[model samples]
Target: MTSDCLFCRIVAGEIPATVVHETDATLAFRDIAPKAPVHVLVVPKAHYADVAELAKADPALAGQVLAAGAAVADAEGLTQDGFRVIFNAGEHGGQEVFHVHAHVLGGRPLGPMVSS
Candidate 1:
């Protein structure tokens, strides 16, 4: 785990978080600065810079992270009403956190997410 990486810190329990889900491969937790009522971040335990980084080192891990995201939505009961899974790639995309993570959002109408 990267000592300076926030996500790694979360995984290491250096920081406190309201956990939503966890597995051998990943962890899901409530976002400290949430955008929605059900905003959660799903990340791999092992650090990767971003999607571009993850895609090469562990393609299976990338798919697993996405699968876990769906599991989080299902567990949170956001599937019926519908939910959105998003990953911001870089600074240009408003990715304040460098570690690869998927944001699971729902529980209310998400209008024009791509408009911005």
Candidate 2:
């Protein structure tokens, strides 16, 4: 786990979080600074700097993250009307968290998101 990564601390139980779902490989929690009505961030347990880093290591892990994100979107009741799943790959993409995370946003008029 990264010493200064907030999500890592949350996963380790060092920090408190309202977790929505968790499995062996992933954890879904509410974003501290949510941009949408239903903003959840699903992240892999293992530490990967960003999507670029994750993509280079294990392609399966990438699938797992996406699957987890889909599961969260379903659970949050956004399947029919739809939802937005986003991953900020790098600085240019506004990836502040560093660790790989899929943002699940829905429950309102989503309109056009920052990215797909």
Candidate of highest TM-score: 1
Worst 10 residues of 2 by lDDT: 107-116
lDDT of 1 by residue, 1-116 (tens): 89999999999999999999999999999988788889999999999989889999999999999999999999999999999999899999878889999999988898977332
After TM-score superposition, the amount by which residue 1's alpha carbon in candidate 2 deviates from its true location, in angstroms, is: 1.0
- Writing each residue's lDDT as its tens digit, candidate 2 over 1-116 gives 99899889888989999899898999999998888888999999999989889889988998999999999999999999899999988889888888999999998877875433
Candidate 2: C-alpha RMSD after superposition: 2.0
Please give each candidate's TM-score: 0.95, 0.94
lDDT of each: 0.92, 0.89
**Most accurate candidate by lDDT:** 1
